[model samples]
Target: MHAPALALGALFSATAAIAHLACIAIGAPAYRVMGAGERMARAAQAGRLQPALVTLAVAAMLSAWAGYAVSGAGVVGPWPFTRPALVLITVLYLARGLAFALLKPLFPGNSATFWWISSGLCLLIGLVHLYGLLAAP
Candidate 1:
């Protein structure tokens, strides 16, 4: 009925950490799996993507904790910030996911289909997280 706080949180957390690690040293082949286009691949080749992805990974870790807290598992003492924060996080994620697909000018060189599918997955993840957050007792 609700989110698997421990499991899903771990999933998110591990995903972030590993993605960061991949960016740290795996190079362009990894970015290819992430659907990076020519320009992005250039960036990776030039070694610009790693720092950016690593920075994002830090935020992703925070998001994982937010997901856990909103699930009502491992919630810290009586904080009033959970509901609104989760709402905002969910909205932002949904926006980011959907916008990537709809905005034609974005991520030039990558196939629209890839971005669309990836964005759809992001939206699905966000929605599932929202469902658990809203369902929390």
Candidate 2:
């Protein structure tokens, strides 16, 4: 229940939710913004983006849940589940960051610079969440 944890979680979740929603609104065009190529965009336009966008939206909500949990809101649980969920969230983020950072093979269409920057940002986000969780009282 720390201020920094709450703030960071709120900020990250809000931005993530908004970004994912925007991507849903824009459909395939958003893929270009995400560093995906025209082919990927076309694929997304062909109806592949819906599922991914929805999943991302859910992930954003989960990030928000992490914020709430750390803020002592009692939104998801009693300790057993809450603590484990928080830990999972931290690991999830770290995994995402590393995969994006070192495993550029995930998005072949994306540019190296784009992957590096995005991955670095993801790593930073993960670290922030980790810090918030660890600092939680």
Q: What digit string (tens of lDDT, one per residue) describes model 1 on residues 2-118?
A: 547433643554565566456546666765666656666667778785545754676476555455443444434434565665666567657867788466576577766658766
Q: Write the per-residue lDDT of candidate 2 for residues 28-70, one digit (tens) a residue.
A: 7786786655666777788885546654767577556556544
Question: lDDT score, residue 119, model 1?
Answer: 75
**lDDT scores in order:** 0.60, 0.64
- Could you tell me which 10 consecutive residues in candidate 1 have the lowest summed lDDT? 70-79
Best by the lDDT measure: 2
Error of 1 at 48 (Å): 3.9
Error of 2 at 87 (Å): 1.4
For candidate 2, report its TM-score: 0.70
C-alpha lDDT of residue 98 in model 1: 75
TM-score of 1: 0.68
Q: Residue 20 in candidate 1 has what lDDT? A: 49
